[model samples]
Target: MRIEPAFLFDLDGTLVDSVYQHVLAWKTALDAESIELSVWRIHRKIGMSGGLFTNQLLRETEVEIDPERIERLRRAHAEAYQRYASGIRPLPGARKLLAWFTEAAIPWAIATGGRMETAAVNLAALDVELTKIPVITRDHVRYAKPDPDLFLAAAERLDAPIEGAVVIGDSI
Candidate 1:
């Protein structure tokens, strides 16, 4: 089947196999705070921004974690994540799919909830070309996924119509 002319993809589980790293980071961060949350539960919140995910997870556990405290833990999680940065790898067929788009002259972009700095670091580890593809990350939008802000921003920046653009993600 012919692919869509414009492709908008998620960065984490879609392009790179960094979900485990995210889980590890969250686990380490929560552990530091003496809060024992399961990695499986944290894995379920992987796609959202650090602050949002932390809030959601805390609420699920019925824990009264201050927003400021959550932010601190998020920072620590980011630091812990950097240690496993080298383990990041592109998902099977991701590079091939990207190359196919390039060769077919189909425009593509990334719309991820991750902060731009973190997204850049992960993309660099995966050897993706930031300059060649448009990236609409958390820094580019006030709201994240399920809100359509990030994807809309990416389509806008890519000059691709939303109706004709395909949003590809591993999960809803």
Candidate 2:
């Protein structure tokens, strides 16, 4: 017997055209915190967990890090991202592909490193109904990408084994 593979997707840059928005949002947050960092540098950390991204950036910039500042940055990014949400849209083929999967009765889920506060914007662009779809966000898991928690949880949501799933994303 062969098992049908399940598809696990990333929401931000994969399904929605929100990667640059995320970079700019981070830039906004960093600027608000008086942290001077290049936009390209922030882009490099887009798909990573926010905590990891913040810690790495602070270490690289030799800046003092504190929980209070991290919270502030998170809030600022969420607010800034909301400002750019109006510009977000589904990728050219993202909606079509999802439709095809639905028509074909394929099991799929979205697993994003973003927490719900920011992910809601991208998900809205994709027209994803969270109640009908399995969406594993950073808010639902202890760790994010590179830790496999998001993908693992997504696979579980689909009742599919991790070995029988494929991850689709636009980042590392």
Candidate 3:
């Protein structure tokens, strides 16, 4: 019997229309640090880990951020995100796609740069249960995409082969 392919999805842009919310969250976080940045810049680095994202943002803009300050900013962002959680929702065809995978017994999972808790909150907001799907977040992977570590890690966790898996992401 031929093995079925695994559908690997990215959380922010691919499965849901939460990019704007994320931008807002980051903006809110940075604002607490008195740093202002463009949503486009934040959007472009959506798939990197929070620390890396912050570091990259600082580096690209030649801004300096204290370590403790960055942590505080992250916390502030989380709070802001929780406040607007209800507005987050899955994109068109996302639910249909997941259902299709379920009905077909095709293995599917999310490989996202988001923290486990944050991912959980967003998935819950979207009415998705992670227990039904394989998920590999920043906590589970040593490296994040566009390095393929998260995707490869998801495939491993699902007992699925990498060559038989296809990654569906909006951007690198």
Best candidate according to TM-score: 2
Candidate 2: worst 10 consecutive residues by lDDT?
121-130
Candidate number with the higher lDDT (2 or 3):
2
Taking the tens digit of each residue's C-alpha lDDT, what string does model 1 give over 1-172?
A: 4435688999999999999988998899889987889889999888887768988888898878896888778788888888778888888988888888889988999899888756876788566788888988888898887689988899888887888888999878
| TM-scores for the candidates | 0.91, 0.97, 0.89
Where model 3 places Cα greater than 4 Å from the true spot, the runs are 1-3
- Compose the digit string of candidate 3's lDDT tens values, residues 93-140: 888888888898888888888877678776775566767778888888
* Rank by lDDT (best first): 2, 1, 3
Worst 10 residues of 1 by lDDT: 1-10
Ranking by TM-score: 2, 1, 3
> What is the per-residue lDDT of model 2 for residues 97-137, given as tens digits with 9 covering 90 to 100?
99889889999999999999999888877888888889998
Q: What are the Cα lDDT values of the candidates? A: 0.84, 0.91, 0.81
- Show where candidate 2 strays beyond 4 Å: none
Q: Supply the global lDDT for candidate 1.
A: 0.84
| Backbone clashes counted, model 3 | 0
